[model samples]
Target: MSSTKVIYALYNDDDVLMDAVKQTRKAHHHIEEVFTPFPVHGLDKAMGLAPTRLAICAFIYGCIGISVATWMMWNIMINDWPQDIGGKPSFSYLQNMPAFVPVMFEMTVFFAAHLMVITFYMRSRLWPFKKAENPDVRTTDDHFLMEVSVSGDEEAMIAFFKNTGAVEVKVIEKH
Candidate 1:
């Protein structure tokens, strides 16, 4: 089987990883991926990744949720089976809007949260029982790992990573 050579640079600190990322970008080296024990702030910006549109999607989902909640509540309370509770039989949605606020808020939050998770999973191509793609298991503990594809001289790339504060650098063939 054909395999591609890649350099795996390990860092003990997030700061070092960030600096390495910047240096790699400055050197015009493409970073295949970065694995960190936890979320590193501004890493995406440093990597020059575009802003995510998840917020926009969440807003749209919230709108749909509120609309559904409103229609359901109106149909049940005003149109289909008008309630005559507390001697308020106006059957007007606007007049009874305050009473539906709780349901609307709940539905909005539920839809936004659930749909956003689904969107993130689908966008990331994650699924149940999928094999892990992590190159190094240390990345899941206290270390950060950067995967850089080798384009030219492997030794030069290794030296570059070492100069960029990598605690350990190794070249591996990925199938």
Candidate 2:
């Protein structure tokens, strides 16, 4: 398999990291990953990442949950059991819908949350309790880090990194 060389730069400032990403793109170097203590808005656009579709998926999943829960409830109470209880009309959903609202809401939230989390994890290449590929742990807590993949002219990439205010840079190798 073909692999690329990557360099990690750690910085304490989020602004500097944002600027660095813009500068790196300006220099036309390909950056592979960015680690930040917290989210920095607009970094995705700066990195040229396409807008995510997870929200759409979440919505669809929520709709599915609602439909299944509603259908199951109606089918069981009206078709399977076919029993009216406590002077309530079980055969008519419009009259008994207040009872199913809680379940429908719960199912919607359940499906949305679980499916959205799964979609996010898959999209981010993350799994439960997975060790990070990043070398520095501080980047997740208090530092911003950028990883750039270098090819052909590494010197130029190094210069570009340094010029963009990278506090520390370390080369990573593939075995």
The candidate that wins on lDDT is: 1
lDDT (tens digit, per residue) of candidate 1 on 1-175: 8999889999999999999999999999989999999999999999989999999999999999999899999999999988788887646999998888999999999999999999999999999898999988999999999999998988999999999999999999899
Taking the candidates one at a time, how many backbone clashes does each contain?
0, 0
The TM-score obtained by model 2 is: 0.88
Output the worst ten-in-a-row residue range by lDDT, candidate 2: 150-159
TM-scores for all predictions: 0.96, 0.88
lDDT of 2 at 65: 89
Off by over 4 Å in 1: none
Residue 85 deviation, candidate 2, in Å?
2.9
TM-score for model 1? 0.96
Residue-level lDDT of model 2, residues 1-95, one tens digit each, is 86657888778888889999998888787888898878899999999999988888989999998998999888988778877688888778778
